[model samples]
Target: MSGKPKLHYFNGRGRMEPIRWLLAAAGVEFEESYLEKKEDLTKLQKDGSLLFQQVPMVEIDGMKLVQTRAIANYIATKIDMYVEGMFDLNELLMMYVIQPADKKEEYFANMMDKAENRYFPAFEKVLKDHGKDFLVGNQLSRADVQLLEVILMAEEYNPSILAKFPLLQSFKARISNIPTIKKFLQPGSQRKPRTTEEDVARAMKIFRS
Candidate 1:
C-alpha cells in the first residue's frame, strides 16, 4: 500500500493466484495481505479505497486496482513480465476457460455441487484445437500460466475430463515440467489448489485404471 502493491483476499486461492505469480515471475515485491471472509468492506468504503467496492483488491503504490484480471494484467505490464504475444493468447484462453462456466452454470454448479465447469469438453478443446504449446506457443507466457492452472483445476475437479484432448494433455505436460516453471515451483511461490501433487496423484490413479 505504501510503495509496492498489496493484495487483499479471502485466504483461499481466488483471483489473486495468477496476479501473485505474475508479480513473483517479474520479481516485483508485493504484500499478500489476506482478509477473512467476514471482514467488513465498510472500512474500504469509509476510506473510499476500494475502487470497485470489491474484495480481491490490489493496492499498488497507494492506487487501488479492482477485479482479478485487471490487477493481474496491470501488474504484468508494470513488471514487463508478460511474454511476447501474451495479450492475444490470454484473450483466447480467457474466453475458452470462462465461457462454458457462464453458459452452463447449473450443470457445473447445481447438478454437480461444484463451483467449476471443468468437465465441459468444449473447454478442453480451446487448447487442444489450437494445437499449440504455451498457449501462444513455446515461450512461457502469462497465458501459459493461466491455462496451466485451468488444466490442473479441470483435471482435479472433474477428473479424466482433459484426456479427451490428447494435444492438450501433451501441451500441459510439457509446460508443467518446464525448467522455468519447475524452478518457480518452489514452496516460496504462490500456487493453484488443484496443482497439488496429492490431487494429481488421485487423478492419475483413476486414469491408470
Candidate 2:
C-alpha cells in the first residue's frame, strides 16, 4: 500500500482473476503490466524478475512475489478479505477428485467428471449447511470470489455444468450480483483468456537463446 503495486501477468484471467477480484473488492489502486506476448515473460525470466518463469507475478511492498496462490493470499491479507480456515477450502475438498494414477488428459477428464458428480453435490451440501449468503462467514471472503471464478470457468467449458447444483447455482448468481463483481463482469477492457502458437514459439526461442 505504500506505493502503487504492479501486477505482471499474461493477458488472461486464468490465475490472475482471483487476485484482480480481491484488489477490486478491496478498492485498492494498482497497475497491471500485461505480458501479452509470452516472449515478454521470457525476457523477465532472463532478466531475473520472473523467478519461477511463470505468469501473474506481483510486485508490491518493495518485493516481488511468485505463484498465483501466494499472490492472491497476499492481496487478500492486505485487504482483510482473507478469513482463516476459509480460503483454499475448495482445493482441499476437490483433492480426491483427480486421482494420482491418472495421466494429464485422464486427470483432466476425471476432474470434469468429478466436478459434476462429486464436487458440486458436496458444495451444495456445504451451502445448505452454512448460509447462502457467503461461503465462509456472513461477509464475503476471498474464498467465495475464488469459488465464483472456478464456477465460471467450469460453466464456460460446459454451460449446463451447474444445472444440477441448485444451491451452488444460486450461490453463483448471488456473488455475480455484487456491485464490484458486476462491474468486473462487464465485457470491457479485460483481456480474453488465450495464447497463440506463435507466442509459444517465441517463448521457446527465448528459452533457447
Which candidate number would show the highest TM-score if scored against the true structure?
2
> What lDDT does the true structure give each of the candidates?
0.55, 0.66
> Per-residue alpha-carbon lDDT of model 2 for 1-209, expressed as tens digits?
77877888755444566677777665566788877555777788888887777667889998888887778777764333323222343343233323354454565666678668765676677788986587766888776777776677666556898888888888999988888777777787342443344444544443344
Q: Give TM-scores for every candidate, taking all chains together and pairing residue i with residue i.
A: 0.59, 0.73
Candidate 2 stretches with Cα past 4 Å from truth are 36-39, 77-109, 194-209
Highest lDDT: give the candidate number. 2
lDDT of 1 by residue, 1-209 (tens): 25777877644454566776666555566776655323345566568877766667888866788887677767643323333233333333333333354565544444233222433343355566656564454566666665566555545545775545676677677866766566556665555443343443443333232
Task: At residue 59, give the lDDT of candidate 2.
Answer: 91
Q: How does residue 18 of candidate 1 score in lDDT?
A: 70
Candidate 1 residue pairs in clash (backbone atoms < 3 Å): none
lDDT of 1 at 5: 79
Off by over 4 Å in 1: 1-4, 25-29, 37-40, 77-132, 183-189, 192-209
- Per-model C-alpha RMSD: 10.5, 5.5
